[model samples]
Target: SCPLILVLGDQLSHSLSSLRDAPDGAVVALCEVAEEGRYVPHHPQKIALILAAMRHFAGELRAKGWRVHYSALDAPDNVQTLIGEAERLAALYGCDEVRVTRPGEWRLWQAMQERRDAALPWRLVEDDRFYVTPDAFADWARGRSTLRLEGFYREMRRHTGLLMEGDSPLGGRWNFDHDNREPLPEHLEAPEPPCHRRDATTREVLVLVAEHFGDHFGALEGFHWPVTRRQSLVDLRHFIANLLPHFGRYQDAISDDQPFLFHSRLSAALNLGLLAPQEVCAAVEAAYQDGKAPLNAAEGFIRQILGWREYVRGLYWTRMPSYKRANYLDGQRGLPDFYWSGDTELRCLKRAIEMTRDNAYAHHIQRLMVTGNFALLCDVAPAALCDWYLAVYADACEWVELPNTLGMVLHGDGGLMGSKPYCASGKYLDRMSDHCQRCRYDPKRSTEENACPLNSLYWRFIERHADRLADNPRMKPILGNLARMSDARRTALRKRAEAFLATLDTEPAYGQGAHS
Candidate 1:
């Protein structure tokens, strides 16, 4: 009988060390059951991306002459949970034991452990691929409390010899964030993003996902993401050659027309294990070394994969289940209906939402500012916003999405993930992108002419939540702006905001559903 190994959906790596040197006649199993797909009503395009990638990777494993068992979501014997399916497969194969690499999700990890304790001997393989190990992170996190990401990031640089020269950073500075925040110019044309012609296999999966999840939030016709390892490499190489040169300067800039900007659209591949973090980091480093891309660009891009990505994963392990529930602001308003429908008159909001709906992908700024900012200011519940983010984005996982949404976006964890809530007026958006040029609402006005919803909402956010936010040391400046307002003027602004929020469809009324 062959030894059995379980490969979760996220563990579709070809170079997985666990699969290497396995005894002859071992069976590797990959399943796509309801439990994995229906966890949060994932976008149809996201499901197609994963399942297509898994199937393609599975074919590669079979070509290597290993016994491969693959299951689709609609399989007749579809058991919902990973353990139950694993046990059934093991029994069917008549295998003595099962092995798997450490899972990306904590819930799956605990379930696997519980099953191992009860069932046959199950070996948990180490995920040595990441820059930091769980034990190493724990050691670094020991004793002296607060886990500041910047400090930990410096430690990682030292440990990995990344961005380092002897004991210090290469440029005698640890961070180049100030040099990396320039907004896009009015006349600059964005480079055309790389194209990946979809294969028959991917087209089939797309049809299946669309049929199954027709009522879901995002669009499927516009899905052009890479679905194979070969295409993922092409996307990475394309970014290195075309976009990496200017990625650092305008990474945070938002625009209605230009959604991808200079950002690497490689997060999907990284999350799927088609591209390793080290490989991505090393490639960018090589770009700097070869003088093809600037230091700020290379370092800034590397910081995302090495620093923020790993830090979020570590924090997920340190605090979870409850961390998903934290709503320090005590926001109770329901999410706006437009979030699900993309039917808003606010041009900035509509553009961001349309991009997300079409691609199931949005750059960091769009997520943090356009959609997430609305959720926070309107007092939508934290978990509600987090779930919506997780369900919508292709790159979202519980670990990455929750912290970025709850801490950075909502400021719900009281500034744990970010120094301040990423709150801004439509003026900031107006300065950053061309979104204002095509909208019914004017970005300049706060309470008139079907005014930009963000205008009134910005002031009303501070006014309504002043009691909770006023005492915050970091938030005092914004509160002072609110405090300086005349009582009568502030009352008018509040009335405008209330009137606007009252028209939203799904509300305990957060938005007044003002539409063109």
Candidate 2:
């Protein structure tokens, strides 16, 4: 008897291991279940994008003469869960067993593991499309006190022979980060990202998503994501040709007017398996070798794909089932009401939220420094913020979203992903963007009327966690500065921050807290 090959929304690649070497008569199953869509109130655009991609891939598989059972969300008698649909199809097709690529999130993987005694046994095939495997990453991480990205990144460069000159780095150094942090110049122009024309499949998916998930967090009016390999390649080519040369310099710079200054918009495509990472990184490295793009820009873009993307996936697999609940600093505040509504006086946060609401995207700086930074400073529960991020963004697979929000963004993993909390005052936002120019609040002033809430909240966060951060080498000097403050000055700032915090975050973050 044949085995049922199950494909998920995120696993859209033609080269997927489950479909790669299958027998000639195997039945391929592609499903769009309601349970997946409403799991965390996923953005409508995310649902549309994935459903369209899955439909397109199912068509591709059928064209190659493989038997495909496509399950649309609106179809009568459709099971609402992945595992349920998988077994139902297996039994219907007279298949004795099921086969699938490893799932991207831990919850589904664990669910699959629990069904060992099902009528049709399940066989999981390891996905090998990336630079390294999870077990290999665990092997590298074994017996290490600290796992630094730089160290792992350099090793990947050596293994891949990318931008290397026969055992030596092409630029004499592994990282070009210092040269990549320059502020955006006023003369610099923001290039437009390529928007694909919606085909019949995309239009149908959009309508389905709207009818089902209209009340989700993000707006889908301007839904224009690349849902096919051809469209994704157009995006990759456009980035290399137009935005790459300046990507490194202004990567960290934010603009209230421009939401996607020079950053690549290929993340959603990459996460969905519409584009392969190896080909993307190779194209970037070739641009640097041909001198079409500067080394800093080329290296910076490639590192995001080859270094950070791979690192996070590895960290997620190695640390899952326990990594999601870490609250090292014991943050206990619920996610604020403004996070969903975007009704805030803070201009930087307002801009980021508006962008996410309209486009289902914001660049890395806006994510890390704006929304993520504010959550870290406010001591929001890691799960609350993590779920918000997962619900709001198009690219947020749990493997990536959990690592960034729970570990890097909130520093909730203690020191596993980041050495110190990524907390900063309003001044950091002012320096990074032009957001403060027209805002109602003062970035420089604290403990007074019209002061930016982030300013006092930042100091309050430091004061609350002074003992927790005192021993950290990077925070020692900052803690000393807090120590040198007078009692009156510190008290005023604390009172201001507490008053602002009290106005928001009324719901409990997780549970009854022993703040210690």
Judge candidate 2 at residue 452 and give its lDDT: 92
Give per-residue CA lDDT, model 2, range 248-352, as digits (tens): 988899998898899889999998889999999999999998889998898898889889999999999999878887889787788888888789889999999
At residue 372, give the lDDT of candidate 1.
86
The lowest-lDDT stretch of 10 consecutive residues in candidate 2 is 507-516
User: Which whole-number lDDT from 0 to 100 does residue 487 have in model 1?
Assistant: 89
Off by over 4 Å in 2: 505-508, 511-516
- Global Cα lDDT for candidate 1: 0.81
RMSD (Cα, Å) of candidate 1? 3.7
lDDT string, candidate 1, 355-443, tens digits? 88888899998898889888877888776777688888888767677788887899887766776678888888888778888988788
Clash list (residue pairs), candidate 2 = none
Best by TM-score: 2
Candidate 2 yields a Cα-based lDDT of 0.88
TM per prediction: 0.93, 0.98
